[model samples]
Target: MTATAPHFEAPPVRAPRRSVQALLEARFAALLVAPAMAVIALVAFYPLGHALWLSLWKINLRFANTPWVFVGLGNYVDAITDDARWLNALRVTLTITFTSLLAEFVLGMIFALVMNQSFKGRALVRASVLIPWSLTTVVSARMWQVIYHASYGVFNRILVDIGLIDAYKPWIISPVFTIWAMIGADVWKTTPFVALLLTAGMQLIPGELYEAAAIDGATAWDRFWRITFPLLRPTMLVALLFRMIDVFRMLDLPFVLTGGGPGQATETLSLYTYRVIFTDLKFGGGSALAVLTFLMILGSAFIFIRVLGAPVAGAESER
Candidate 1:
């Protein structure tokens, strides 16, 4: 009997197999997503590939019977190294981007803080704050254009009333004022969006943390810097990313407000690209500009994800 028991071996352990139902469910989910994937590939990827292809060839519609000439990054090289207007556009774009971003962020933080405070008309105030942002960009630009009119504009009236200027200034016509005026309008329109996003993020922060900080004898500013600011960083980064992408490709405001005018003083990359493509009939050059803009935006997003993603993820995990 002992010899017989010793001769028996334990059954080998086997991993549990996935059920056919689970496999079927996964396949069904993939099938459900296929249509959306196909649409994206068709609408987005196809156009993007076409643009890249077109960027390599010179296609000037202005010339009769001219065939597509392969330039092999000539447009890109011209834009980057040889094109003075392109360089100036780049400078103007960067100036507006950074300046407007800073103003919006600071004002947005202030607005968020004020809105976060309990008040009798907080809801109304928040709704009012969102009004500027709610307007379509084109409409907002048109409105601001009216506001920046040299004569009979409220902006000049306010300045004159405050004794800041002797007369109404030509804000849109002057090169010095044109870009700044655009920056101001951009900040006014977008700060609310930034504030709204920050407010949402602030809501996620636990009240206990603030209370504990207050108990530790931390001042309001101290608490904000030490607790609120740190916690809000992830949200700020996300807002910055969105705003950067938008402002980089900015067209409507500049196009409508100044028409990239006052002699190309306020010309953005997008507006310049538009001019090149449609106005100058240079499809290849315009495509190259579009591709370059896309690359810049993509690079910026990649940097944000790679650099700031870790901290954001860590914050989420901690929470």
Candidate 2:
């Protein structure tokens, strides 16, 4: 009789998919995303559109009285076929980006390893390592300019004292050596930053893995190659990507130190773009060059993502 009399209530139902509450939540989400989309359009797409419009004209400020004439893609054509200096700048930019980043990665990894060790003075060492990175690019370039001076520079003096050279050479004057000097300065200044990133990555790795590897009789080199490098690959790729982008857009050092001098040996795409826009006063050509440079950078990022297998975590989660 009790069982027959007993009754139970069903679970409460969820609101309908197209209900007022669901529609309100959907609208709120769209509203939140709208601001970001608007900001991106304003900051990024607007400039790109303006550049595209500018690129279609022949507007040289030097010709103050002349009107803006449409040249269509003539600026782009000249950049590829006619402008030798622009081509040279592209070559130099690629050279610096590749070589400097290579040295930075290797040296940075070494510094990271040293800093990751258990030591009494580790904090001090880490601080000292970051000093060069903390200094502004302009300050570092100007300082290196003095250091690379032919006669009175510390570098030349040390080389002479050590018998590496018979005389103080004009390091910045030679086209061949000028890039090397720039690379040296860049590597010295930014390697510490790479090291800092790598050190942080290394710290995240569990010590248990290393201890287990040691128990299995793995040598230091084996542990590094098998465990450390494999684990730190994502961090290394991220550091490499950042430095690549930075070096691609490098201007402050070249502007201050080389001025794209010694026969245009150190002219980067960014430096070249600046000179074209301000020095040559050809806004159309400069805008075209800017667009081309942007495409190259995008291509490089694509290559890195493919070669390193470092799919962005946020992108993966979104998918």
Candidate 3:
């Protein structure tokens, strides 16, 4: 009788409630990222869009009454056919890109190999290698400009002293040598950066692989080709892509050193764009050049990724 009838109640079901703190946190995170995104859009994309818009117009800055009338690809036609300067600029630009990139890649690889070897003071050496890269591009260009001066430059003195040349030669003043001189300066300045990236990649490789290869009687070349080269491919592609982009838009060094050269010999697309915008005050034409250069760079990067077997974002994520 006593055990017969105890009243039982069901456990209460919890109700879902919105978390104010979590909502606030999400909002705060979005707020934090929004400023950076806005800045990037304004600084990078806005100008690009504006430039594209300007490119379609026929606005000459010299004419006070000139309206920005839509000219529908006229600027591009002018750039391609009517403007011989664009052709010259393209020739010089391509020459500099190919020659300088080749030299930089070779020298950077050599430097990376050297730096990868175990040695005393290696940390100090690595830090020193980065000094040039850490410096401002303009500052580095100015320093090289002094070094490349015809009469009083240390480079010329050294060349003469070493019997490389009979006397001081005007490197930046001559069209024949100006491109080469610019290439040299660019290589020296950028190779260190390339080496640093390669070195980082190399460091990620296991030392045990090399040891095992050595134990198996693999020669240095064999080990490099079999083990090191394949592993380093991704890193090399990354470095090459970055350097190639920079090379396409190179302006400061050539500008400071030669001001597009003695006879437009060092006139890269960047310098040509600058001259069109500022010197000639042809904003519309300059914008067209800018758009063309942008397209060229984007197309080149796409082609490189496809040709070089680089991993696209989706492939990389899966990996």
Name the candidate that leads on TM-score.
Answer: 1
Evaluated at residue 298, the lDDT of candidate 3 is: 88
lDDT of 2 by residue, 269-305 (tens): 9999998999999999899999999888878877777
Off by over 4 Å in 3: 1-32, 311-319
Model 3 lDDT per residue over 1-319, tens place: 5554454324443443336656788999999999999999999999899999999988788868878788889999999999888888888888888888889878888889989999998899898888878888788878878998998989999999999999899988987888898889888889999999888889999999999999999999999899988999988888888888899999898888788879888989999999899988889889999999989998888876877866557435544
Task: Give the TM-score of each candidate.
Answer: 0.91, 0.89, 0.87
Which of candidates 2 and 3 reaches a greater TM-score?
A: 2
On TM-score, the stronger of 1 and 3 is 1
**What is the lDDT for 35 in model 2?**
94
For candidate 1, lDDT tens digit of each residue in 1-319? 5567544544443445336656788999999999999999999999999999999999999989889999999999999999999999999999999999999999999999988889999989888998998999999999998898999788999999999999889999998899999999999999999999888889888999999989999999999999889999889998998899999999999999999989999999999999999999999989999999999998988888787772345334644
Q: What is the lDDT of residue 294 in candidate 2?
A: 87
Local distance difference test, per candidate? 0.91, 0.90, 0.87
Q: Candidate 3 at residue 117, lDDT? A: 91
Candidate 1 TM-score to native: 0.91
The residue-level lDDT of candidate 2 at 120 comes to 96
> Local error of candidate 3 at 121, Å?
1.6
RMSD (Cα, Å) of model 1: 8.1
